[model samples]
Target chain A: MSERIVVDPITRIEGHLRIEAQMKGNRIEQAYSSGTMVRGIETILKGRDPRDAWAYAQRICGVCTLVHGIASIRAVEDALNYDIPKNAQLIRNLMIGAQYIHDHVMHFYHLHALDWVDVVSALKADPQATAELAQSLSSWPNSSPGYFADTRRRLADFVESGQLGIFANGYWGHPEYKLPPEANLMAVAHYLEALAWQREVVKLHTIFGGKNPHPNFLVGGVASPIDLNSDSAINARRLSQVQDVISRMRQFVDQVYLPDTLAIASFYKEWFKRGEGLGNFLCYGDLPATNMRDRDSFLFPPGVILDRDLSRVHEIDMHDKAQIQEYVAHSWYNYSTGKETGLHPYDGETQLDYTGPEPPFKQLQVEDPYSWIKSPRWRDKAMEVGPLSRVLLLYASGHEPTRELARFALAKLDLPIIALFSTLGRTAARTLESKLLADAMQGWFDDLVSNIKRGDTRTFNEALWDPSTWPETCQGAGFMEAPRGALGHWVVIRNGKIANYQAVVPSTWNAGPRDASGQSGAYEAALQDQHTLVDSSQPLEILRTIHSFDPCIACAVHLADEAGDELIKIQISG
Target chain B: MNALKSIPVLVEAPATRDFCYQNTLPLLHEISHALRRLQQEQLPTTIDLNAIPFGPGDEQRLLEFLGRGEVSAHLEALGNSSVWESGYPGIWFIEHRNESGERVAFQMEITTLPAILATHPDDIAESLSSLQKALENPSLGHRIGD
Candidate 1:
């Protein structure tokens, strides 16, 4: 008999995500992924001034906070055919690069490490042994026995006090936990270090955009101005600070994040074999060396890799209506045409409809409409989008650094190329790309400083600042490779106001439910592939695979009706 | 200085009505519950203020309602942290700032003593051992001046 298991309000992620697995004994036969929250940011964006869209769209997800603002601004700029200065482009690159490094490191330590590292077990570890383990990993400065001893003491006190605080409800002693006590202690120590490190690095965003979560964004260019002699503008002091933040970021990624990921992966080598869901991958490349219009200058090139084929890279045209479409067959929504038909985001509609089983209920009616997220398919195929996809795309594109890093990590782990398609590979890919972006940030900063030195410090173009300059009707797809994966904002502006706006975020591509023809989304397919439960009641295996994608459900689902009264209250019970 | 003065300052009028108090009443209720738990079970609870979304003036109003108590402290570690007791005996307000002097966390901890104010046992032991060594060798005390 196939027994069903439900893990609802999945912890350690940005928003509410419920996973249901139909199991035959220990193996998972089928998995259903549902995003239970409705966020109607698109509905809120309708009829608003096109330029102000970024400010509103920035509120979509507090985790991947800056991506939507970038995408939204790009959409408006794309619609207006506005060209910003080279300085603006470089500053934007620095900010985006910082987001990628900051977000990826935090995810590795705070969000996903607990799945592999047992916190409670760290108390039993010998600090001397842990210091030895840490020294072997890398030349991180805080590797002395005394340092590990202090961390262990602090962790012991927190554990003994009967208050786990943020570390509570963890599957600490699960049989599935494979790390040694020393490794666990080392990881726990770095977890605390990462918390402090992240707080410092995010100052990069604050320096440029004025704040961290939902930083200020401008449609024409960045809101920051450059005047070297000035204290308030992008002066010498601020630029030097940006340089310092960048160096700090690169140091952490080089010394701490990279070595820690490899160490953790070495213990869980079996994970590199499983969770290889839907060999397909998609990337909307970002970090342009020149400008957005100059696609060839993109550091991370845009393309689609089908069937994990590194041979031939497929092209993606966001403007092509048939290329990218969202299917709502199993979603809690209805297209004006019908539920079965897929609509391109330019023509995307957000209609509030709840057809799933009401809250405080046992099982979701799996066969019917079950999720709030729309199944975004590229040419009607479920493609995984995230760090693994971006890394694979870069390697396939013959990007030398990405290729070298992947080879180095694979050689270190003694894993084959096929391992890049699995759970652990997805995580290692994030670490590799963080190094790539951190290095690339220095180059961008240098370019910006050189431009300022040459007295070409223009950050904004005032030509299209006035709405009267825009054509009566225009539409554009603003896309970027977010920290999570591919993110695109489709906008249609008529008469200087937003006629329609739809954002197909990264999580929607990976975490949406099965489609009309019964194609499993990335999350569902990965869960069903090579996954076996040690104990059905404690589904640590499920969390490992799901968290590998770094699911941000808040980015996936939108809000409810205008009054918000149409939202269904979901009550989760153990 | 002229460049700094040239920078535009964005200011908005406060909302006519205080929605934060109305919307964040549940937080007040949670504080009450934490107080009760402290009284009944002798248990302490910490509410991360950052976790709660406060509207304009909502945090200030809540702080004003909590008022001030006699006890307050300043601590420096990875950053600077301020802890103070509210008008209510058990409720304490704590704000932690990083090296950049940016507020990292603002929390309302309900306890007899905020955790940051208490010296860790390990630190206490280390302090005792250091003091003993300094007494044995007066020269060791000069190292602090160095």
Candidate 2:
């Protein structure tokens, strides 16, 4: 009954990853997550001015580059104790929100759908019925016969162009594609529509950062303030365009994304059962001004576990570093003594050797150094971080908008809101949050306009807070929400430059290394119980589910490409 | 009726580059030599350095790390204000005055921190002491010095 299902070279994702699932009968018994290749990004930053870390770090992952840019800037800021202005904060929030909407929409339609909905089956869809479905939804835009026809023509043109970046080597006519021909046609048209919309929305980040695909944002504040004529920073028309784009996103998320998720996810109810990894969730508080200082002011409240029918909860003081420790038992490299220690980020070690199992207590003293990423623990537990954690946190904190949005979505789908604990639930929450965030951004924009009109137009502080003047040794960790999930950058600065810079990225929590106890990371645990419904060798479903976690491996990158390098992603749990 | 003029297709110049992220010196050398060969062969791809941030006053941090001294070329001062986190990545950025009325900028970077540490007096002294007994000349660094 035991079988090893390998999903190597996970396609449609940004980077290379392979999932080796040890399945016992239909359920996964043990999951070995392997990522080969060391990009030497830290080496890439070794001598560069620490300020340029953002510009370069963002390039680590294309999809989540914006988050990395912000995270790197935040880390440096933490070292310098630089505080951003209110206008800068608003601009950042809007830009980051734009990325979230864009990412969520792209993930839903482009990446995740291919796993479930068959594309070639779409060719069989009836144009008339597809048109009818479009017309049925009043709020939906461009859902007409002519629109679908144009979509067909455009897809053909692109195919003729031979620029199939997304659709390359696709499993086009999978028998599992469950939609009728007309419905497929409708979805296909929307898919094309989504791509065009995606391009426009990504521009929102460019308006603030100066370029898309990793826009440059200043650490203390933005590079420059928003002014209409100065040709220095982003122009006025661009700002308005950004605001308009945000509005359009709200419309799309509400009328399109949310509805589409429900429609597609409803068909895959079986996924609701399996692929639900470590029910224990951790969401670091986000939106600093909205919930400043008060740790409880999480847009999503702290931590929740759904064992007793989604009833019980607990508070996690993530400050307890002892709870985090990584294991190299199944890893390739050998540690000197196999002793795991709580080393700061700047002093991170990457000793590469495959000496097999490590001895206890000698973890830190291991003669061989392994991995660029250090295992982070939260009360000695592996925590899940992502849309699920964010939404769950929001639900726990009882944010009115998030609460109502969740309720409305569940009601619309006739789903129990508690079902949000499932994968489908997490997906819905993201789409719902997307719609809600779109509306919230409008209000935030208004507040920004008010600030600008009141002669509070200054955005950046070119001043650097002197860390040398302070006590020679003090450590601080920044906990905020990246678009994907919670992101924290811990910095220790001495003299003038940085002495230590460590980060526990959101994906690290979701796709971390095994703990000192050899327990799996969040995604590994999530993949434990799943039926090998199709080809065990190429389980795209597992890839979809795991990638849905969107692990950020760059945070864990070291000189070597061992599990130790990626161990950073797994915020080890108790 | 739609009428359109017939156009003849001609294949000519297309925009592309032989630029690559050469991670090793061998790769860079190989590409350079290949470009030489290609220039002789009149190949299509144009290989040239697009932009290098290394120049005087650029403070190429990489070079600083490698213990290289600072060199100021033609860099516009930030108006005598040193209160910001701005520096040209610790490497010198230089732009020579071209009489043709054009602009040229390039950066020199060589891991500023490591370079500095490698050439530091204390570190050099330690290395010399470690090799003191290996030679009778009594000059640990004299092998490469005056």
Local accuracy of candidate 1 as per-residue lDDT tens digits, A369-486? 8899889999999989999999999999999989899999999999888999999999999999999999999889888877777788898899998999998878787999999999
Query: What is each candidate's DockQ, to 2 decimals?
Result: 0.03, 0.01
Residues B39-101, model 2: lDDT tens digits: 576432222222433222123222232342444333233212111111432322233223222
Worst 10 residues of 2 chain A by lDDT: A361-370
Query: Whose DockQ is greatest here?
Result: 1
lDDT of 2 by residue, A60-124 (tens): 66787687777777666654556778888778778777888898888777766677666556655
C-alpha-based local distance difference test score of model 1? 0.88
True contacts kept of each: 0.00, 0.00
Candidate 1: pairs in clash: A38-A558, A38-A559, A39-A558, A39-A559, A40-A558, A40-A559
